[model samples]
Target: GAGVSQSPSNKVTEKGKDVELRCDPISGHTALYWYRQRLGQGLEFLIYFQGNSAPDKSGLPSDRFSAERTGESVSTLTIQRTQQEDSAVYLCASSEWTGRNQPQHFGDGTRLSIL
Candidate 1:
């Protein structure tokens, strides 16, 4: 894909259900990020991966949230024991390895709803 690609564009699950969101970044993009946006709120950074270095998960909200990336290819965000507050748009973005100011290419995002 020319841009970031996310799966299950929309997902609806029970409150306690577990959900997984996937992201496939553009080829050659070594930097990837995951974020959550609540209604009328700004994007909340969740995790970041770059090259072979350890992923920076400092922004993960809780132990229930986790992410993994296979090299610089695909990434997955998993949420366990989902809560109603988890309803939001989960966005994925990727950028060339430049600097923090590098422009990011984002996906349409996965709309997750915990009912």
Candidate 2:
């Protein structure tokens, strides 16, 4: 793949509805990350996945948010009982490795709106 690819470029849902966002990482990349960006705030790291290692879920704001990745391929982020505050652009990124300085490629993101 050329880069990280996120599906459903945009989404709109009711406050209590649930939504799922998908991401496809570049082939061979071993590190994947999920982030959320509010209207005027900086990107907030949501979770991270590294090859065969335990995923990092500390960044998830609440129990309603979760993510899963199989191997080094696709990832899905699920949000339950969505809230207005959860509305934002969900960005997915992938890197060749999981290092502090490794360069990561990002997808265009899924713009989520909660009504």
Candidate 3:
């Protein structure tokens, strides 16, 4: 893909249901990130994956939220036992990551609605 692509632009589910959001980043991009945006707030960092070493998940809200990346291509964000408070737009971004100020490409985001 030429840019980051996210699937299921809108997701609606019961409060306790689980949801899986997917992100396919631009080819060759080594850094991928996930963030959450509530009704009217800034993007909240969730997790970051850089290459094969390990993932930085310090920003994740709770144990119910998790993310994973496959090499440098695709990433998946999973929310377990979703709560009403989890309703928000989940954003995904990718950067080439050669160090020195690289602009990240963003996906439209998945709008999750926990009813």
Candidate 4:
């Protein structure tokens, strides 16, 4: 795809289950980011990967959430022991660079529901 692509657009899982969300960034884009949006809420930054630099995971809400990007290609966001509060749309975005002024293009997002 020419833009960021995320799989499993909708997921339903029980509380305490673990889920893995995938994101494939646009080719040649050097910066990738993960964000989550709860119902009626704004997007929340989750993690970021830029080239070979160490990923900035400061946005992750807790240790149960983590993400990794191999080079500037695919990235995955894993959430362990899912809770009802974890239900949201997980969005992926990529940009040509990580500079403050760089614009990012976003994916449709994966909607996760915890039963």
Candidate 5:
């Protein structure tokens, strides 16, 4: 892909349903990240993947949230038993990390609505 791409853009779901959001990162990028933003809240880091090292999934809110990355390619975030509090923008970003500081290029995001 040319840039980070997120799917659906808008999702409306009843409470307790499951949703899967997808992300396609920029080609050749080695790092991928997922973030969640609620209304008026800052970006909440959900997970990060770099190369073959361990994925950082520490920020996931609960057992209902999980994600996976295939090498340095596509990634998917799944939220099961969604609740009203789950309504937010799910953003994905990719960066080519060299040493320490590499700015991530972000996707617009999947707007999940759990009513």
Candidate 6:
């Protein structure tokens, strides 16, 4: 089965531009999450979606960052008005809902560069 898939392994854009990153979770997984890892920084949880409930967006740095997931499958994170500070590797993960004990499987991530 496909572990996970993220688009544009790398992305480069100018300030004030927008970029959309996509993620595809493994089949039958019931949990999906998005995280960002800046240079030399640890993973920061961005958003999480489970089933069809509202997404948890508390980790979003600003209104410029947003993400959505459909049922327990694909997800997309959109970064609007990109800024140099927003440049980082955006990672997506998914796993079975066996509780916190179940580890998340991550994608290679989308490296965004704001120039």
Model 5 C-alpha lDDT per residue in residues 3-115, reported as the tens digit of each score = 89999899999999999999999998899999999999999999999988898989999999999999989999999999999999999999997346788999999999999
Taking all chains together, each candidate's TM-score versus the true structure is 0.97, 0.98, 0.96, 0.97, 0.95, 0.95
Q: Which parts of model 1 have CA positions greater than 4 angstroms off?
A: none
- Writing each residue's lDDT as its tens digit, candidate 4 over 1-115 gives 8778999899999999999999999999999999999999999999999899999998999999999888889999999999999999999999999998999999999999999
- Give the winner by TM-score: 1 or 3: 1
**Which residue pairs come into collision in candidate 3?**
none
lDDT of 1 by residue, 1-115 (tens): 7789999999999999999999999999999999999999999999999999998999999999999999989999999999999999999999997387899899999999999
Mind giving the per-residue lDDT tens digits that candidate 2 earns over 1-115? 6878999999999999999999999999999999999999999999999998999999999999999998889999999999999999999999999898999899999999999
The lDDT values for all models are 0.94, 0.96, 0.93, 0.95, 0.92, 0.90
Error of 2 at 6 (Å): 0.2
In model 1, pairs of residues that clash are none
Candidate 2 — which pairs collide? none
lDDT (Cα) of model 5: 0.92
Candidate 3 total steric clashes: 0
Q: Which stretches of candidate 5 lie over 4 Å from their true place?
A: none
- Which is the winner by TM-score between candidate 1 and candidate 6? 1
Candidates' RMSD to native: 0.8, 0.6, 1.0, 0.7, 1.1, 1.1
Q: How far is candidate 2 from the true structure (C-alpha RMSD, Å)?
A: 0.6
**How would you encode candidate 3's per-residue C-alpha lDDT over 8-90 as one tens digit per residue?**
89999999999999999989899999999999899999999888868989999999999988889889999999999999999
Under the 3 Å rule for N, CA and C atoms, how many clashes does model 6 have?
0
Residue 20 accuracy (lDDT) in model 1: 97
Cα lDDT of model 6 by residue, 49-92, tens digit: 87777888899999998888877878989999999999999999
Candidate 2 local lDDT, residue 78: 99
